[model samples]
Every structure is written in structure tokens, then in C-alpha cells.
Target: MAEIVPDVGFLKNGKLKTALLQHKALSKSGLSERLFGLMFSGLVYPQIWEDPDVDMAGMELREGHSIVTIGSGGCNMLAYLSCQPASIDVVDLNPHHIALNRLKLAAFSALPNHSDVVRLLASENTRTNTKAYDNFIAPKLDAATRAYWDKRTLSGRRRISVFDRNIYRTGLLGRFIAAGHLLARLHGVDLTEMANARSLREQRQFFESHIAPLFDKPLIRWLTSRKSSLFGLGIPPQQYDELASLAAEGSIAPVLRQRLEKLACHFPLRDNYFAWQAFVRRYARPHEGQLPTYLKPEHYRQIRNNVSRVKVHHATFTELLSEKAAGTVDRYVLLDAQDWMNDRQLNDLWAEITRTAAPGARVIFRTAAEKSIIEDRLSPAIRGQWTYLAGRSQELNLQDRSAIYGGFHIYTRTA
Candidate 1:
């Protein structure tokens, strides 16, 4: 496959606008959508929120399987490399994500060893990571990806400098987490205390004593009520409505509180990297906490050896599927992108998914609501070809350590 150079002009090209602008310009929803597109056109997720363990289990990924997934933050895509898939095609509309994915592949191939890879990707250090990039990774990158990292920010720091300071703290999601910490500090709460909890009981106690009460604050409730406040979470207006609808009183704060409680109390801090990122703004060291599968030392050699199997594309899932032969792909991971789609987009996406999926192929996606968003929205003709794994989806949803999504859905092509 030839390299598809990323078109950095996302707004000018109108791809993002077409996906997000569901209401008329000048309307309240339209302005919110436009604002979200602008914010999302750049990097959003510094680390993807969906649980890859749940994804691999739901898909039942096997050696030599052909997989296609959205490349958010590139963690899960690298994690999937451990499965030794024949091919992993990653699709994303964001140019920065395309750059990031390509950079990870290059780092795996070019860096000296596992610890160097970990230091560059997972740790926050004063060590000159840029030297590692210059001496090793940069030369291995394709011209487009190399340029992306070399590009200077307003501060004049090279984009790759994020690795030195803490790449996890650099994206929109990172800024959002920082802002949450600031808000909590103003209320005399240090959210990082959740990370100090040594047991589930202590976790729950911290939440009940310090975190849970914030949801009832007049200011917190008011801020969450507005749609613009959640763009950092990558929740567009459409998804925000779905999330807000889940709250019995139509307030997003309670919904947020519920999710936070699960994130803090449902999983042990020592085994959940998602919790570490949420509370501490960086991953825990190897002995202190678990790391993402790709970052784990045991899997490092396997992922590095298989990095060539992964490919990143700057395109939509439906668009990419349209170009593939029927019955070619065995697994699909959509993340939460479906929550942002309209009915027509949903139907078009499923139409191609059904066409391109191999028999017994699996599709996994996350949603902002507990119910499957496509349950009634997809046209029956397109929807009937696949069976929804409701029980299995619910089972896996409970196991997802990320604790952010309201639903995790699985569909298997049967005909």
C-alpha cells in the first residue's frame, strides 16, 4: 500500500465538518459542533479511553486475523500487534493521530531496546528524549511523519519534545485532565488522592468523602450542563446529548460522577493504568502499576518484531471499508466514533461493514448510552445480517477498565 499523505487542512477540506455539522449554521447546536470540530481537528486523546483487553476478548482476535480499527492515541493498535495479526489497518481522520501512529511504529523499529521505548513513550523525564528521536527514530520515519514531529509549536519547541516532558500531558485530553485537577484544587480536593488508595475500600472512601460531593456543587453542575465544556473529552454535541440523557435529572455531573466512581473503586490502582493516567497524569512504574500491553516489557520484543504488520490511514472507517474486498476483514474496532454519526452515516457505515466482514467476523464499539445506538437507527436490511451479542457486550462492558463509556457493543456477521 502506498503512503497516504495526511491532509493537514481538516477544516478546509470539510471532512470533520461533514461528520459533525448536523444542525444549521447559526443554530446553538451548530456553533457547538463547529467549536468541537476545531478542537478535535488537532490531537484529542493522548491515550485512548477504550479498554483494549475488552476489545481483544470481544473480537476473539487470533493469530493471522486481519483487523481494522480506529487509531486513537495508537496504544491499542500497538497492543493488537501482540496478537500477531496478518495485517492491522488503522484509520483515523485526525492528522495528528496519523502522525502519532506512524511515529510509534518507527520508534518500535528504530529505538535500541524496550527501556528506551518505555522512556520515550511512557515516562516523564528530563532526559533528552529528543536525542533518541534524532539519533534513532527520526531516520526511520517516513518524510511526512518526520516533518510532523519536527514541526515547531507556538512555544518553538519541536512537537517531539512532548516525549521529554510527558507526552501524556500534551494533548487535549491531557489539558482537560489538568483543568479537572485545577477545578478540584479550587474546591480543596486533591484528585490524586485516589491514586494513593491501597484498596477498593479506601478508593470508595476517598470518592465518597472528596470526589462524589463535587457533583452536587452548583458551579460543577452548571459547567457540565453546557456542551462546550466537554469537547476536551472528545464528546461532540450529539454524544453529549446521549450522555446527558442518561442522567435521571438530565444533569451531566451525576453521570460523570458515576463514571469517575467506577474508575476509582471498581479496579485496583496497581493493576489499572487507566486509573494512573486519570489521577496521576502519568503511568505508574512497572512495579507500582500495570502498563498498557504494548508498553509491557514481556510483549515488547513481540510488538517490535511485528510492528511492520501495522499500517495507518488518514480516512474514515466507512470510506476505507468501501475500498476493501468483501469478506476480507475479520475484526473491527470502532471506538466511540459511532456516537457522533447521524442515521444516514450509521446506515452507510454498517452497509460497508456488513459487506466487507468475513463470516463470523466481530465488530466492537463503545457508546455514550447504555443501549446500542444502532439498534433502531440502522436500516433493517443492513442490520439483519449481523447478530448483536447483547449478553456478551454487557459482560465485557463491566470488565472495561476505562470506565468512561456507557456501553460496549459487539456484532458478529452471521450471513
Candidate 2:
């Protein structure tokens, strides 16, 4: 195992300060270093991306197309495999994310049955899972993962102890949400009751009472105004800037409040799975303890089989895209990743994207604002070759799960 060093200076006095200072027009090098710091400090998570069911629907993905995706946490890639893609390549800069992806693949590959896998991951309780880990998974893990699982935190248990709790809060964005909840609580707000509202009106009332007070706080407003501070929320600095810029006086609280209001009030609590994860810490479960639609029992075999079709690599998008032969990939799921790139990186990435795209290949991704990042950002020559399906992408989006995403987009290489 590589000996990990604690660079306390970076967190307390380094690029974090630079990021906060130049929140709006963060340079490429600054953004890269900040992201690397986030990855190293474990502020970036194994699973901070949005639900893939929402993403796949937005992409309108069909069978027999290969995809390339950023593997923040492995959940979405597994979700994509359920649709029977020809292949998927999961890329990440964080080794921890790769470790988590490998763990998911290992579980699917070696679990005794689908039931055991569910009992471990989907259940949110790891008692049975720890037993399963000890008996089944622990011995099989590679040295790195074994060390990750074995390392103890200040709480005395291993980091693997997180599986027993609402482990969603362990991720980068999850930690931000947890902190937000704490801050909200300090202001006499309780987010959990947004669930008990019986109607849209009731939901509105709940938010007004329970969620709105934090937005009024000076500290919350100040922190919300800065884009780079939101890296803790798993938002890239660029995307955070765009979202912040959309509001009057560059106040982000109103924007976040409005979007979160939509997530909490626009749909039934039982149906809005994002709210379930956010407010209640678990999704509504049937008596049999079934997972979400994208993670049904029957998909396990297919996911396990298609697991081989995907490879998780710890590298940047440009690095991986540079190695692939032109016209080899059929689909690309960028998942709002482009918002993190600077002009040069964007150009390099799209250059490879244009070169690697097969005829009629589809590319899908989300953004932090309600426009395609590729439109103004990509070179005109490259952008002209890919036809954007503006009308189709809008129709596929579900308002409930996707309230936080700026917008979903799908593009196809010109035939």
C-alpha cells in the first residue's frame, strides 16, 4: 500500500484559499489542483453523482452502444449496464472512487446470490454485510481495499463501519449536505419534515417553515455566493460559478432554495427518491426489501456479466480519450463533467470526442445551468459535426429526480 501523507497545509492554507478567492474565474491549473486536493483529502467521494436512472432516461440510451463515463461512484455505471450497452469505460481521477468501483464489481462477481448483495448495499445496514464481508469479501479484496477497510478512524471502527449508517453522507456532496443540515439545524430548521407534507401546498408550507430560514442567515448567504466553496458539494468550481451567476447579486441561496423546493414540493415524497435520500436517509422499500427500478434483482446477473465490459481507470478524461482509436466509441456519458474543464482541456477533450465518435454515436451529459456546455464552449468545427437533440433531451427529463441537475443533453454525430 502507498503511504498516504496528510498535507494539512493544502486544506487550511493552500488552493482552497485560491479557489475561494478566485471563485468565479478559476484558472485551469487551480481547478485541477483543487480537484486533486479534493480527491486526496477524500472530499470527493465514491458516489456523489446523481441517480443514473434519471441520467439514462435523459440520455435516451439504447442497446448495443458503447459508452464512456466518469465513475464518481460506481452506481450510475452499474445502472447503465442494465440497459445492455455494448460497453462502458468508467474514468476517475480519484483512486478511492476506483477502489469503490472495484468493490462493487467484486460484489457482483463473487456474492453468493443477488439477495446477499442487496442485503449488503441497498439495505443501508451493514451488520449482515460485515458478516458477509468477513466471510466472503474480505479475503478476496486486493491489498489496497483490504487496507482501506481495515484502517480505523477516530471513532475506533474501520471506515467500513460507515456502511452501517446512512452511508450516503460519507461522500463529498454527502458531507456537504450533512454540514448544510447541521447549519440548518442551527437556524431552527428541520429538513426531515418536508416528507410529511400531504400535498403540494403542505410541502410548500413545510419548506417555508423548515427550509427557508437558513437562506436568511448571513453566513449561509456568504458561503453560498462563492462557487469554489461548493466543491465540497461535489459541484465543480465552474458549474458552481454558472449556477451562482444566475441569481440576482450573485446570491446562490435563492437558486438552491428554488431548486430544492422543486425537489421537495413538486413530487410526492414517496416518489421523489432524491428527497428520500436527502431527508429520510433511505428510499421507500417494498416488504421484500427490493432496490430501485434500475437495481432490481434480475439485473444483477446482467450487471455482473456486463461488468467485464467496463473498466475503471484513475485518469483524466483527456488522458483516456487520447489513447482510444478514432471512431471506436458509440456513446459518451459525461455526467456534467465538462463543467469542470477549462478551455484548453475542453478543446482537448472534445477534440478526442469528435475523433472517437462513430457515425451516429450518442453523447449525453448534464450541466449545472440550463444550457449545453458544448454549444458555446466547443470549437465550431467540432460542434457542427455533432447534431444536438435539444427537443428530445428536454422531453426525457423527470422533474422530480433531476431538479438539482442544470439540464440533460444528448448529441449524435452527424450521419
Q: CA RMSD for every model?
A: 1.4, 4.4
**Candidate 1 similarity to native, TM-score:** 0.97
Q: lDDT of model 1 at residue 295?
A: 90
Task: Put down candidate 1 lDDT per residue, 1-415, tens digits, no spaces.
Answer: 3454544654674556777789987998888888888888888887888888999999999999999999989999998888899999999888888899899888899999998888888889746799999999999988988988998989999899988899888788999999999999999999887877888899889989999998999989999989888989889999999998888874699899989988998999898899999898999986788888789988898899999998788778988899999999999999999999999999999999988998889999999989999988989888888899999999999999999999999999976
Q: Which residue runs of candidate 2 sit more than 4 Å off their true CA positions?
A: 1-40, 198-201, 287-293, 398-400
The best candidate in terms of TM-score: 1
TM-score of 2: 0.86
Q: All models: lDDT?
A: 0.89, 0.70
- Number of backbone collisions per candidate, in order? 0, 1
TM per candidate: 0.97, 0.86
